[model samples]
Target: MSGPGSAVLAQLLAQSAGQGADLLALRAIAEEAGDLAAGRALARLGLEDAQAAKDMAELRELLAAWRAAKKSLWKAVLGWIVKMALVLMLAGLAVKLRLWELLE
Candidate 1:
């Protein structure tokens, strides 16, 4: 006989057809399947919910870290490019005035 969790999963899957299920919902269903296969129930469902929450929290933290790193990298690259351009411009002016030959 199917359990309450199976009923819930079936309903969620039906409702989510074509649009794709939410990550949390899919996690819950996967946990439910494991528990059902193992002949267990509520405990596994609760554990699955906790796991899903933890996963979401971790994902958010990672995304924030990535964004911060990307911003920092872009800033550093832009600063380096600006500095290099200025150095090249100065070098060009020095060469035009024969300053480079004097140093040689």
Candidate 2:
């Protein structure tokens, strides 16, 4: 009830109010039409029920959990790769210095 259509309806209601008792029917029709439009819009948006808020909240939480899991998975993979790289570097250095021969 805050857009151009509502504004026009408000203006029409005001004009009808000043026109006299004969326009009361027109006023009632306008109000009914506004209510019907609002109801239809709510229906279209699938938000006509009390559970809509709870459903939206659950969806948001599910999305956040998915994002968190994805982030942690990437972090684990990167950490593993880094650890492997470090181990390989250390092994390469030991081979270059012939450290295995010392143990032989």
Candidate achieving the largest lDDT: 2
- Give Cα distance to truth, residue 64, candidate 2, Å: 0.7
Superposed model 1: Cα runs more than 4 Å off:
1-48
Candidate 2 RMSD to the real structure: 5.2
What are the per-residue Cα lDDT tens digits for candidate 2 across 1-104? Answer: 68997788778777877876457787678779879988899889998899988989999999999999999999999999999999999999999999999998
Residue ranges of candidate 2 with Cα displaced over 4 Å? 1-42
* lDDT string, candidate 1, 35-91, tens digits: 686644545655445576687789899999999999999999999999999999999
Which candidate has the highest TM-score of all?
Answer: 2
List, in order, the clash count of every candidate structure.
0, 0
Root-mean-square deviation (CA) per prediction: 11.3, 5.2
Using Cα atoms with residue i matched to residue i, what is each candidate's TM-score against the true structure? Answer: 0.50, 0.60
